[model samples]
Target: MLVRELLKNFQELANKEVEFTGRIRSNRQGKNVSFLVLNDGSVIDDVQVVYKNETKNFEQLSKQRLGAVVYIQGKLVPTPNRPQPFEIQAKISEIISECAEEYPLQKKEQSLEFLREIPQLRPRTKTFQAVFKIRSLLSFAIHKFFNEKDFVYVNTPIITENDAEGAGEAFVVTTRNDGKYEDDFFGKKANLTVSGQLNAEAYAQSLNSVYTFGPTFRAENSNTSRHAAEFWMIEPEVALNSLKENIDLIEELIKSVLSYVLENGRKELEACQNFFDDKLISRLESAKDSKFKVLDYAEAINILKEAVKKNKNEFEEKNIKFGLDLGSEHEKYLCEKHFGSPVFLINYPKEIKAFYMKLNDDKKTVAAVDLLVPGIGELVGGSQREDNFDKLILRSKELGINFDDLSWYFNLRKFGYYKSSGFGLGFERLVMYVTGATNIRDVISFPRTPNNLLF
Candidate 1:
């Protein structure tokens, strides 16, 4: 039976016979009766079992190891004197699976770094339970938001012939022996795609409205908390949209996702309130109703310059000029210190951004936006694409990208191009923002970090 069903029956079935099979959380003693907290991994709290009389096994059941699984036949009775509503008076208790006493997860709190060593068992902890619950809720919210808006869910290829980001940050796929290298499928090289923007663009033009929510691989070896080699991204592309409309869609998409999680995952949020900043739900709720502050790269540069002039920055930002990629410190200053929340930095330098971004009339900047939040510096990167085929080809050639392989992408423009926009939001980063878990490694069930591929 589901734990929820068991909970609903707790009051109605009080003083009645009950049977349950679950894992034991803790076993201890009282004056006469022994207590055991049991859970099936379905609910956050455990069902308390009280053992009063039996054979030598009754004492043994009371002393069962922490991670041991057990079964019990008992009577449910109201505990008016206790904190919880009910407790199970067990007539017989049977041990199922006996675990070694050296289980890593003691009842005490373990550091996140220690949990990283045992990724397989980390999800069993209270903190990870909350993180994953929020993650699941946000995922459903993404699908629901797009589904309601009449957007088609498109599955773009994981292995592809094109490097859509044009930054050469993809992990090449190969099936070769130690002595030599073999060709990829169709005798052409392939790699895990860094972004599905190019593929999603084709589908968006045909499907009119589409989004791709899937794993995107990047070979960027930056070992920051936000940078994961393999991360899930949510990219939504829409046809016949201006930059302002695209920004509006982004704002709405983020707000809707956060709102869904806050509304539906309240229990998990309460469990995780200690790990994050004090006002997580309030922050998300505020964001839902609050308008995002927008600033251009040039304006942000001026803000940074003024900070430098006044010696307000914590460290020297010698190279942080107009066109430089905003460092983590700079991004934090813009969103946390100055703007005080999530802020959008728009119209970045064309040379620094991806190739597909549309070049503005100034010819030096692209219509791009990077969503910067308080803790997670860069949660999203997206932009409107260049609709003009000639401009796209010129940009690609100038950037030394092989345009011949991207014929289908170019063909989208050939068949009458329309202005469209898309962006990529890191799934783990969003989880960090919601759960207040500081590390990305803790949010994922099995985190895949560089040189550390443990089960």
Candidate 2:
């Protein structure tokens, strides 16, 4: 029987014989009996197993090392007024496998940095057991949210020719001995895709709604606590949606995911609260019910400028002005300090935003928005796409982009154009927000950072 099932059905399974196999978390040997705490990774809690010297295989079982796997056939008996509700009274027990004393995971507190060195074994720890469980559930909730909204799941290619962001941060896909395009795999220059929005757009134009969840690569060298060499992104595109509708979708998505995790993942969240941040649960709970604020990019810049004037040395990069990109510090001050909630910073300068965003009537700003939260700076970035073919071509040429390479993308507007909008949310950042794991490396089971890729 699975430990989780046995525990959940304890009242029904009381006084009945059940067999379970799990790794020993802790073991204590007494003069006539032994106690074992076993975990099978099905749930957050472990089941206790009681064995005596008279039980079968007592000699071998009692001498088994920590982390050893064992099978116990026993009856469930109530443990009145204790932490654990029930324990197994062993009728027959045997050691399935033996672990040497050199087992890396000891029953002691280990630093997160130390655990990073042992990613292979870290999942067995209580903290990771909770974190990854929540991660799995949240990922499911994402699919469920989109599926319920009548969105089709599209599996876009991992390799492509167009730089969607046009930031030149793509990891080039090249295998030719002489670096010649004719000898490459696709017979043209290609790179690991940075975003699936363009491909999702293709499916959206046909299906009216589509989303892509997949791995994305960035070749940037900044090794910050938030930056990773590779990450997962959720990009959804819909036809005939304006910038306001896109923001509404983003807000709904955040609240829905948070509510699902809070309700279905209560145990995991509680465990995380006890181990990591004390405010993890409260932050999530408040976020789900809070009224999200919306502020234009120009107004946000004015607030930052006034902030700098009042207090010198407020921000690290303190020169606050319009048309300048908002740094993480500026994002935090606006969300945490000013609004005390999530804020949508919109209508950024055309020069700073991507070429695909729709241009406003002022001809200087684009309908781009970034969802900024308290602790995490930017959680989601989205925009109303440029639907006009000629205007898109103009912006592409102005950005010094070779228009021919993106003709396939612009052809969507050429053949038939429709109003559309989409957004990209970093999966790991969402995990960090939910789990309260500070560093990007801690949330990722096997993080891939600059010069640091380990299993």
lDDT of every model, 2 decimals: 0.83, 0.91
Top lDDT hit: 2
User: What's the TM-score of each model vs. the native?
Assistant: 0.95, 0.97
Residue lDDT tens for model 1, 5-115: 678778788799888888766888888778888777666667888888672368668678888888888788898787878888888777788879899888888888998
Model 1 segments beyond 4 Å from truth?
55-57, 80-82, 177-183
Location of the lowest summed lDDT over 10 successive residues in candidate 2:
176-185
lDDT of 1 at 422: 82
Deviation in Å, model 1, residue 213 alpha carbon: 1.1
Off-target runs (Cα >4 Å) in candidate 2 are none
What tens-digit string does per-residue lDDT give for candidate 2 at 1-455?
89889889998888999999999888899987789999999998899999997789988888887789999999999887899999999989988899999998888888998998999888888889999999998899999999999999999989999889999999889987687987788989999999999989878999998999999999999888888988899999999999999999999999999999999999899888888889989999999999899999999999999999999889998888888888989999999898889999999999999999999999999999999987788999999999998899999999998978888898999888789999999999899889988788878879888889756
What's the TM for model 1? 0.95
lDDT of 1 at 317: 60
